[model samples]
Target: MTMTMTMTIAGACPGFRARLLLGGALLAGSALAGPAVAQDMPAPQKDAAPGLTKVASFEHQVTGVTVSKDGRIFVNFPRWTEDTAVSVAELKDGTLTPFPDAEWNGWRNAKKDQVDARNHWVCVQSVVADPKGNLWVLDPAAPAMAAVVKDGPKLVEIDLKTNKPARTIAFDETVAPQVSYLNDVRFSPDGKTAYLTDSGASGALVVVDLDSGKARRLLDGDPTTMPDKSVTVSYDGKPLRRPDGRGVEFAADGLALSPDGKTLYWQAIKGKTLYSLPTDALTGWLTSAVVPSALTDKSLSGKVETVGENGPADGLIISRHDGRMYVTAPEENAVKVRDLTAKGGTPTVLVQDPRLRWPDTFAEAPDGTILFTTSHIQDSAFYKPDAPAALPTELWSIKPGAAEATGSTTAPK
Candidate 1:
């Protein structure tokens, strides 16, 4: 049996210390389920702020969402649970059709050698569309957050116009290592480089060169990428913990790129602080003659800058229209917007709703609509083993005042 399955079985046991250790180890190791108890869940705020609308709902947990320039919506459901049939799918006319074809999504139970890991979507964490109108799928290759499949981790680029995969870039140990979990990714304005967050056993930033298909790991275990053990995430006015007594902890998640492709913004799920750094510093590390195997806090001392945020955040995105950064603050069940151009400016609540359980990722449409998904992560099986079997995950879209004012028709990079 897999370690994840063992952990799941052991976690359900009644011992306090053992269960606690198992749960904590599970949380430290990686980052799950169900039902239809709608009445038990918090009710949607009747007076929810305007400009918010529900675009779609799903029975499975969804954490990553991206919309193409032409308004083609795509979502990804991680294999944290047992029932994730489709890793990457397109939402068309209220139905989800597996992107490319069903054959690519049919590697769930196949043996590592029997399947073409590089060509198939083993376990997709995020799907993003670039400024050039191509969709890129990120697969960490670890199902149920277990061991990484051989030659499994990869970034697949698909041509939206043809709805067919254009290329596949497989990542090896140097870039993705056994412990690496590629959580989220953002592309540079020029689409030459891709920045990804490693939120698994260690925290780091993985930079990929699109032209050469070469990837380098930087800032490995850096303070900015690592989770602050001192910080505790709370949800619904209580410390967010698993039934086995482990606290929720995730490192180096949610990434956003500046309009000019100079600054990269990122934060940890278990941490309250936000951070940004010059893209050049990260890209420069690749060419350094004495590039260390792992970068320390001191190595990036002057290059990394901490940005103030209201609380812990998940998915983060910068608005192309107004140049503001939108952070999903699950602690307050609200989305906060900060003016990137204004120094020392505080983030303001752009929208709040009780139904915003845990907003995961952000995507901007050509029509000035900002799209996001609420996975209700705190209520998942990872935290509550007895969580309902049919939870409702929602995709929401809102046109903030900033987006409406610009009326920009440009696509997000």
Candidate 2:
């Protein structure tokens, strides 16, 4: 078998594929994904331990951050607090400057207006610049996580050089706007389409056809995409609850497309379980009768939760080199890795830091440096409006070799 296939299988089923099935039987119907006994998974090799050194931090509250192909960093400042302003900025020479110098407002297409002091986009939650150097702006424009607005939920495409939006795709009530807090996005390997996570009340996976400007929402409110009730996430050892006492939580936040672009893995912000589905099943452009069954492959039905499996995980990364996936767990103040080659290896803790507050997003540098954000969002005023604010939110980076060498990387299942 080719290395890719061999690794995919190995990564998914370490040495105890059959044992994992037996384990699954114990939790039948619910779902169980594993290679063998969680304890039996071999301990990963430890040689060169890489550590997360504090690189750069933001003066104001940080929302989302994305690293460019050339290593330029872009971040979003949402209007979460009452008086604070909303804007997108770039990190240059260690200074945060207004990107394209525009304040947060409503969005418009490239043909509409240029970004200047007067006219700008608003309420951007996440920012991702694609491989082709196009910046994608995800706006979920309500005060905090409340999905009260309709016209403002949009995905704006901005040209890097001009800082002008080339296109603006708006979400309306028909598309369940209130339920669509558009979160993160990942481009297909070919860059022909982009998959966005609707982390709003009604969890969904939104797929956009870049060329046609057509968009579709699938797996809408599906249980797999939603966080289970029994799962309670404790940030920094503190239970995370909603400000309204209504159980504040997330359905999906961290998202990524596999290197081969065949599957999309995602997990809820407040959820402990991780789920994935075939990308082709989600594209929704094809009309084959067997498409439904293809979308529900039994192999893909297993639930991959790292609640107790891995540390409190966030920010997942899939290394193309070995088809292994990595996750950041701020609760444990660590980063973990699982080899898909073993199919179900136990997770290993690669990096841990008591100071790494709520490590959020992941970005890959050209030379394999893994970039991630540490927002300490749980400690923010948004979560505890009455508490004092923690300044100096940081963005961090570490190499895979460094992560594995240290106990930060998790073992395969």
Per lDDT, the best of the predicted structures is 1
lDDT of candidate 1 over 1-413, digit per residue (tens): 10211111111112101011112222332110011111111222234346565555676778798877766668887777544666787764324667777777766655553468778878789999998989999999887667787899999999987989999999998778888788999999899999999888788888888988878888888888888897899998899998779887788998999989999989898888889999998887666676556656466646789877646888899988778899998887778888877766568777777778898899887655677899898888788888864455877777786434543122212
Error of 1 at 341 (Å): 2.1
lDDT for model 2? 0.59
How far residue 5's Cα lies from its native spot in candidate 2, in Å, is: 48
| Angstrom error at residue 83, model 2 | 4.7
Ten consecutive residues with minimal summed lDDT in candidate 1? 31-40
| Model 2 TM-score (2 dp) | 0.74
Candidate lDDT (C-alpha), each: 0.74, 0.59
TM-score, candidate number 1: 0.83
lDDT of 2 by residue, 303-332 (tens): 333322443455776865556677877666
